[model samples]
Target: MMPKITTNRRKWKADLMNRVQTVDDNDRPATDYTFKRVTYFKPLGVTAQEKALSVQEKAEVVKRINIVMDHTINTKDFGIRIGEQLYNIERIWTDDEKREMELSLSYVD
Candidate 1:
């Protein structure tokens, strides 16, 4: 057998045909009826380089560097392969290079 209507069709039908009362005279146009261009901003990839660290940031940097340096030296003493690579990287890092890196590190990190 066909099922009885479970929904109220009259209430739903009346909603779409409801009359709207105008605030202004029907002849005068709305001043702010400007159609703003629908802006479709593409999915923004909010990726960017890290900013330079300030003195507060530098403190964290120094702490990390010291710990890393100690780890590298200890690894070298133990004859680990990475110890040499770490040391080599250390050699390549001059004071000027470090300062520059410190400035840029915040952004990268």
Candidate 2:
């Protein structure tokens, strides 16, 4: 069974975006991303983890958030934006009942 969502917890909002490719004046290829307001849905949960390696001297952080499922969401054509930061969708998990989905997102600063 899915966990219950409360009204007070529904404070977080995110945008669903689609990537578009375009050519610049110099004939160089570029990406033009457009976004649409999905809804004001709260994250069911959040998990943050960090990983580091000495050889590469690089650190990576991945955050997982769950929200109520929207039928329009698809991994192939859409991304998630919270505030001004854009996140890459690494994975998506939808419940059997299709009530909610968990999104694995990663971004580097």
TM-score of 2: 0.66
**Per-residue alpha-carbon lDDT of candidate 2 for residues 47-105, written as tens digits (9 for 90 to 100):** 33323321133423356667777777775566778888877666677885847778766
Model 1 over residues 49-90: C-alpha lDDT tens digits? Answer: 211233434422211121111212221112111111211111
Number of the predicted model whose TM-score against the real structure is largest: 2
Model 1 lowest lDDT segment of ten? 9-18
Model 2 has how many clashing residue pairs?
A: 0
lDDT of 2: 0.65
Give the TM-score of each candidate.
0.13, 0.66
